[model samples]
Target: MSRELFYNSQSAYEKIHLQNALIFELSKVTIPSIREIMVGQLNFINKELAQKVAAKVGVQVTELEFPNQSLPADSNYQDLQSEEREAHTKLSAALSMDNTIKNTIKGRKIGFIIANGVNALHVQDLKTKLEGEDAVVEIIGPSMAQVTTNDGSMVTPKHSLTSIASVAFDALYIAAGEDSVKELLMANNKPHVLNFINEAYKHCKAIYFGEGSEPLYMNSNISLKKHIDPAIVSWEDETPDNKFIDAIAQHRVWYLELERNTQD
Candidate 1:
């Protein structure tokens, strides 16, 4: 329908065509409960849009229904909402961030974990590429100092490894050395790092890891399998591929399926 009405047309017509699409979608949602939630979200995104769309779709504001007056326990409704989001994401790749790379890299930040002995050039090259794409990359050195690489280049530290936390960035790049790895294990802050990665995974954040950092991502019995998405894994970077990078740029595995008990 959009193709029939607005294909090969000017941008001015997109709003009009999209409005028509909204009405069609709204009509197909037979369940009034779904419509109520959708309309609120739609309105939040664009008020004039919500007003115009509901009117164009012939849905009166007064006609909206709130069937359930009492809220469910936090455990019940919250779990249901999570399941619904996963269902919506799985509905189509078009609805998933794992599928789309929005052009704007605004507020996108990259964290690089490195030590004195590692290859500084590799880290620099990766930074150059990411920066070219408008991503901010920071050098997280093991300690504050100039680290002489195999090629004898002075790689200065931006932030110390101990000072940096996973929450510090949207995505993480690990150029860790033997020392950093030892530190991670010796001080195995399992709960914290695990929580960070889990949160990042849940929030659709990106993670890029090299051979040295692979241990950090070694799946520790946590099931990343729930989503059936390979994009969620901690990755090896020296052998870079299009799909993983694309997935990183897109930023999340929006396609998901939650395992849940059947409703009675």
Candidate 2:
């Protein structure tokens, strides 16, 4: 049988196109029942969406049927205190400083290694800045007795290098001045001084050096030239205080992992 009906071809095409567009726009709407059923399986909980949909449709999500899926708990699942707590604790521990010591270096022990003819200005600037941030800054020298600065001012060391190990301080700063660097290099034979620096480097502690302090590092370990990095910061480039402070706050550098791997 053959039958023909006259109709506007343009009208038919437009009607079909409009129907497809409407279907696409409608699918963009998130289905609340489906989301509620996949709460644990997806990145977000749909409790709020479920409530909104239930209100609009005048029905409970529990009325919906899920043939092969597990529905979310009836109770609210929006709170994530447990998950947030774990993440917070882990990050804090890794940084070695909790919220208490984040902005300020409060209670952290910072050692300034100096000797005869040490740069008085460098020592003063670093000590003042660190102490202003509430960190405990102590002067360490070869002797617990008095040492002279480049300006002929007598400064006493709070602790001797031999008495206190590098592990005792959170960070170390070597002052600038040729005389101090020369003396430190001469003392390289003393295993305690070299071991102190080496141990600090191995442990990934921040070490700051002034312009003339390179000799101390170079003489302590000949291989230092190969792996020196920002973990061993220097004022030679006139680096700003904030850069050093931010590095200290990070507690360790990504390069430390590289050094550790090489050692292993």
Candidate 3:
């Protein structure tokens, strides 16, 4: 029973570690006051971790603001367990937007996936912008060093699709044209599509989508919404639908639950 309980307790922390949330454990009957006290105590035990995350994500436990709210005596406590787990997860993953925004942008690699007859201007425009931010952008396509643009420019692709695995990128921007997108939808290539998102999601890396790139995320495990707008970081989506990039870059949504997760 003790061994089983130990693992059960661990599940909470593991969930947060994997997802990147922060929380302190409490006895089932512990008060919200105690939980807040625990958070305060963690400040002493791990001040750097506390101050760093507090700088961006805000270390205050926003959800426990209500008075006299404690887990019910009859409560199964699954909620408590889930909550603690998520807290640890987010704290581990917090990198401040403020700090990240200030860092040197050198050596950041952005991979653009495209094919023959693609829009050369889109690729160039994005590459130029990213380079302005000090990121190095590379093109991955059919054969080495060149793909035809839709508007008729001869463009060079730096890495072949076979060689440019998704993990090779810090962030991925996919702009597969109609033909490429459709072919990626093929039954045989479905695994390729799934594998791409799986690898990116597993790594918790950032992905930016061009039009028609939704299908790549259509069949991945784990809820896309869970990762879409990560609770731990701030993402400024240039496009209306792609804001999740910030949280994904922060990597791991967190093992803890937020108030949103505990909704009835």
Candidate 4:
């Protein structure tokens, strides 16, 4: 319909047909119930429509008095012409939809930074839980070579630390094992691994440090922060896995970006 409306060569009959089709499609849209509509932050225009919809649905509307500061103090809707008023109503509906949040962690890309001597159990546990939630997990090693866990089991990494940056994934995890942490802290690998953590911290992405991984956390820029960031999960927390999962679902903790970057 939009294409037909903008077509320069469209005949008058075709334009009329497009208008009728658009009107028919608009008319078929179901009027949402008061509960659904109320989920959105309402403005004056939407509030008026909500009252009428509630009445039609046999729900009593409760009036909550609050100042509508979105508009100027001297602004008057009555001053607007018919076309301008219609445009304002459309804009209000679009903005309301923009503010809605969908809570889910499915399909999120999670990166695990590891090295030789990594705790296989630590790697498997959280990886299982996250994968169960339908998230994609990728193992990252200091180099392209295979990583040998503490138990002598070999694990292949999907990416090398220097090959990919923190921006490639939605979140990061450092598994437990003193030997693994030591391997990661080695002269050659330390800077590359720290760069991944620092970049992830700068972007406000969730970072989980398992037991024995504290040294890596302390060395990163995260340790310089003035305040605690909920998205930065440490091994000391009770049920750290649950906390990490919840943080990932919330997406980035953007509100604390400044505090996270500020040094004490």
Where in model 1 is the C-alpha error above 4 Å? Answer: 1-107, 143-152, 161-164, 176-180, 188-199, 219-228, 232-241, 256-264
TM-score of 1: 0.49
TM-score of 4: 0.63
Candidate 1's displacement at residue 136, Å, is 0.8
lDDT against the true structure, each candidate = 0.54, 0.61, 0.51, 0.73
Model 3 stretches astray by more than 4 angstroms: 1-104, 142-145, 186-190, 220-227, 230-264
Per-residue lDDT of 27-83 in model 3, one digit per residue for the tens?
Answer: 332465554544444443344434433343434533333222356887655555422
lDDT over C-alpha atoms for residue 261 of model 2 = 42
Q: For residue 17, give model 1's deviation from the true position in Å.
A: 29
lDDT winner: 4
User: Which candidate ranks first by TM-score, i.e. highest?
Assistant: 4
TM-score of 3: 0.49
Q: Give the per-residue lDDT of model 2 (tens digit) for 1-264.
A: 101111111133322333334334434558755444433222122334334334443334452232223336673344422232222121122322222244546677878888889999878988898888778898988887798999999999998888889888887887788888777767443566677788777666778877687766775542453565666777755554555666666564544544444553
CA shift of 70, model 1, Å? 17
TM-scores for every candidate against the unseen true structure: 0.49, 0.57, 0.49, 0.63
The residue-by-residue lDDT of candidate 1 on 1-264, one tens digit each, is: 221222223232334445556877898888776666666556544455567567755554433233232466554543343221322121233432333455455557877766556656666777777777787888765567766664666777787655666677777665645544444444434444455555555544566555566566664223534434544434343356333355556554333222211112
- Candidate 3: how many backbone clashes? 22
Candidate 4 global CA lDDT score: 0.73
lDDT of 1 at 84: 15
